[model samples]
Target: MSAQDRLVGAATLKRLRLARGWSLADLARAVSTKAKELGQPLDASVASVQRSVARWESSKGPILPGDRYQLLLAHVYARSAHGQLALSVGSDFSELLYALGHLGESERRLNDLRTLLVRTATDGGSGLLALLGPSTQRVLADALADPSKLDEELLEAMGIAIRDVNRQVGSLPFVRVQLMLTPIVESCRRLLDGTVPDAVLLHLRAVAAQAYTLAGRAAFETRDDEASRALYAAAAGGVGPPWRRAVVHMSHALVTLYSTPGIEAAQQLVDAAVRDARAGESVMVRARAHALQAEIAARAGSARHAKAALALAWYDIDSDCDGDPSPASFSAAHLRGFEGLTELYVGDPSKAHDYFAQSAEALHTPRERVQHAIVSTDQALARIRLNDPEAATELLHGCVDAASATGGRVAAIRLRRARAYLRPWRREDWFADFDDHLIESFGA
Candidate 1:
């Protein structure tokens, strides 16, 4: 470590605040917001914020408030100075460094993706996208200063790879896709800073958005809620068409739902999705969207609306599910699982139990697939409500391996909830055994 390393924590905070032209008060407010999200409401009074900001920036106060705080801080600074940020807070957040480090990995990914494309890209990476039509070279941009022109084909190839990659994310390793695409997204953003053809520029923007979206999906599946939200927001900026924009909004809503329990915020996202979908006119998008809408409506104390939206979702499921669904389309099993979830949220665990059981029966005839882990956990939740605690325990034990493999954090959340439900019976032998299993599947 160098001399500057000693001062990293305070200096880093000061620098970031300055870069954003934020005062001590402004920094305090942002910190307060982060704190609120973590369920620690800050005073936010000018006096409280100013003093806290001073102490934090000077290292005179707690540099890291808590593990969750540090993780949230890492997320807030995820896009800029991520290396320095990581080094500064390294001691405070060793377990969470992987989340922050991925930010830097995006920059390095550009070269790696280029090499990969040159060697073995199937279609999207085939020549990295070489498409030419009706006099596009002549329809140039006034934005171009004619510097060393970059390869449009290569950039287009990167974009195609991003869109194509989303199809496989459901089956492939989420971590691998996140690592591969984020860097390409960053490279696309860097390229956009330079002059390129208007057509190429627009194409680059769209691809970057999609890359961010795909990367966000990976982050979400991995249970990195805050990072997923930020990535989705970045993706939302470059959305061009109505259908894509609708998907972006819907995706943003999905992340928001996962991150917070605030019904108002969830409603806002649903409304945004609805507004964007009007132009797209796809029953498929609307269908998938209603599944979310059902969840939000259930959470909002409107069982009638939840049921209505879920019915619409069922109607739309087959509209575009005939072998060639869009990247965001829901399968019959997914819709059924949501139907079960809506029942769970709408105060009917018996119906929820039946829905989840039916869905699981259809989806899990072979073996407990990784993708079904969350659904299985949902089934377990319904069992908890059904007073079949032993059955709930058995289901969780069966699904733990697959659930942890797919999304450990979500699995942990479900397990944690199960543990809480079983708390009153902790004295029982079987309950004690189930408690140990929860500890094993998740952690204490």
Candidate 2:
């Protein structure tokens, strides 16, 4: 059978199977028995069913007895089940088969389907509740409640889940499911016996490292530079060669860039991070290191170096990762925001606005989404540069409003500064309100 024919058949079989409420085993059993009676026997195990189902759903396959049996089973099963069992068992079976049908075509779509199934099962049903005994549920819940106690496997799973959930929701709000899952994961780690293998320890360290990196980002946003630095440093301390160490150093570079201790010191740190990241294994880590280098260069008044670094960062963002690119690359609205700011600094507000708009669209988290407000403030600054104080006032007001809504005090302060810079073109009274607000929110 041609590939196209197999895909067509597979898709049809998948729809029919899902429309029915039967498991692979159930369908295999019925189909196998029917085939036997018809003088053609086929295996009915999960693997056999999987294969037969694959053939039937294949768009390019020659439709055989096995395919016919699969279609028949789907027809019979859909009309047979009812109630919670019907919904639970039927949906699970159908979803699984449907998912399998798409496996060869789009792995990402299959992954999405699987995630949906797991999340649905997690959130639904007394049947699911019974499947996971109360004791097991309690254990998992307790384990995830404390990060310091989580084992390696659980930590890695949690890390993946956190990223997945963040992608789905577009924001890592403090009260989100990821936050709820963190403690349970930590608890599991803490409860781990010394029997864990070295391989497991490596994986655990990676998960912990990622968690610390995220935590540091949160801290940095809140103006807790000390805490942010500590978390980033902790992430760096995790075990692994170039990848892990490079990430840690990059985190340090980020903190240093923001702290602005000195251009020379910051550039040195950035250079080291870039070197380590280049030697690292993960493309994601390398990309981040490059991004940080770009930021540092941008801050150092070397527009040429900044542009080069940013270009490298963009390349990393575009590169595919081991068949599965990092979501950070795809979901990086903040990069555009940064790019917009970079363009603005380099005297190209038009390009800056375009990048800023793109970044705003890509931003996923509330904390970072407020970065759009910062962009607006920067736009206002640009307008001021152009001697368009009236337009700048309007933009700054929007910036303030956006920042206030998202709890972006830092952005708000910047907006206020922009307003202050434009005060000479405004009534004297306009200065007091923004001035007082900045002082109150950001202090001296």
Write the residue-wise lDDT of candidate 2 on 168-208 in tens digits.
32132322333333443353245343344455667766666
Model 1 C-alpha RMSD vs. true structure (Å) is 19.2
**Candidate 2 regions off by >4 Å?**
1-137, 140-153, 164-195, 239-252, 259-269, 281-288, 314-327, 330-336, 346-368, 426-444
Model 1: CA > 4 A from native: 1-152, 163-173, 220-226, 318-328, 362-371
Per-residue error (Å), model 1, residue 76: 44
- What shift in Å separates residue 265 of candidate 2 from its native position after superposition? 5.6
- Write one digit per residue (lDDT tens) for candidate 1, span 1-444: 233432455566666667767788876676677667658775557568667556656644324333343444544443233322221112222222332232222323322322322223222332212111112222222122341364566555455555545533333446655655655656656666776656566676777788788777778877787888888888888877766777887777766666677767767878777666655656677677788788889878789999998888777775654443254455677777888888898868988888788777767421235446668888988988888888887887766666555454455666777778877778888888877766675566
Top-lDDT structure, candidate number: 1
